[model samples]
Target chain A: MTLLTSAVAAIVCTIIWYKNAPKNDMKIGILCWMYWGATIMWFVDAIFEYAELKAEYFSPAPADMLNDFFLGLSVVVFGLIIWLVILLIKDPKGVIKSALSKKAN
Target chain B: MACFLISTAEAVVTTVAAKQIEKNENLREVNVSEVKYSHKTPFSKKLKWLRNMLWGGSALLLFEHVWHGEIVPFFPFLTAASNPADAAEMLHEMATVGVTMALLVTGVWGVIVGITTAMEKKAEKEDAAQIAEHAEN
Candidate 1:
């Protein structure tokens, strides 16, 4: 549920960025990549849950799969957060300027 | 950008339809000043009406899904329950969190759409007024 909630948050942020930002802005591309990365994490989490449900058929243990999935996803989401933060910090004025210019036209 | 393009297209179609209807009615030079204002109705009142109509519809649909037990199978935690009453209680608990997240997503999207639409309308009105002034000159 936490994973899905975070994914929902990312989706909302993406939609807001798309609607308000400049058309075809490079930042949108970055945001989209981040969204897809998060989505992958969500799917991985779901798969782990499903595996746990069918533990009789699976041999290697659900705990291992869950741990690996969580570690991978956490790393990916962390990296995306860093990237997004750096983007927001660097050239913040330029982002607004481009968006405003597109709006004006 | 896709949403903006679609909105602009809709605006164009609306304006064209309005012009055609006005022509058919044989109205000459429709004036904004001719519109009447009611003291009892305020802009906020109209906005509240619109918000209720739109957001209320969405909320009803979401609640319907909850009532029907449609969202239960999606979460693995809820699937462990066998009894209907227990499942309902579990779903009710999960729904508090799920609905809150969904509302957050939808609310943000609505605000973005509203702002974008408002900006587009302002630009279109400015453009139309400019054209009218040029024609007069």
Candidate 2:
């Protein structure tokens, strides 16, 4: 479940990154990389767990799925927060720079 | 049980290496007049891309492991560490799954760097041609 969630996020983020590749004002590449890395990590994890559980890996408890889904969601949120920090620090668009200069004026 | 530790360890090492490279890069100066082409972003800045990818993925995995009680705030920290059998299995998983994930991410970053370098080269050639045309005008 976690793997599915991160993989979906990675796909959507890739599309966004591709569309914004020309402008690249927001640095969406960071988010794309983060989610893609996570998706791969979870994919490997799922493979190993499947090896151990075999048939049981397919049928997970509803509560466990819910928990895993929430974990995946949290991971996505955390990635967003990290990207936001990088954006603010880098200020690729100079939004923060302009705001600070305006305040000084 | 503690598969993510391998990636986490790699991240830690790379973070230190990145910092060192960044410091060295900061000390170096680019001679704009002597160079026909230059990278818009420095190598150190490019390394940050790999650093961010590794750190972000490792942090999320750490959180997930903690959520599942695979890790705890204790002397050994890993639940598998308490049992010799589980500890061995954990080590095996770390070797197989963890190392594979780390290598995959690093490999992807390498490809990204290659693409970026090629694009920069193309841009440099275009810039030189434009400058030559300006000179002719």
Tens-digit lDDT track of model 2 for B1-137: 77777777887887888889887865665433455347566777777787777877887788788888998998799999998999998888888998988888889889989999999888888988998999999
Tens-place lDDT per residue, model 1, A1-105, is 334544664576568767877654344444443443334333443554566578653444677656545544453455356556656666455976687799999
TM-score of 1: 0.32
Model 1 residue B130 lDDT score? 84
- What candidate 2 gets wrong by more than 4 Å, as runs, is A14-29, A50-64, A81-105, B30-37, B133-137
Q: Score every model by TM-score.
A: 0.32, 0.77
**Chain A TM-score for each of the predictions:** 0.46, 0.96
- Winning model by lDDT: 2
- Candidate 2, pairs of clashing residues: none
Q: Report the number of the highest-TM-score candidate.
A: 2
Best by DockQ: 2
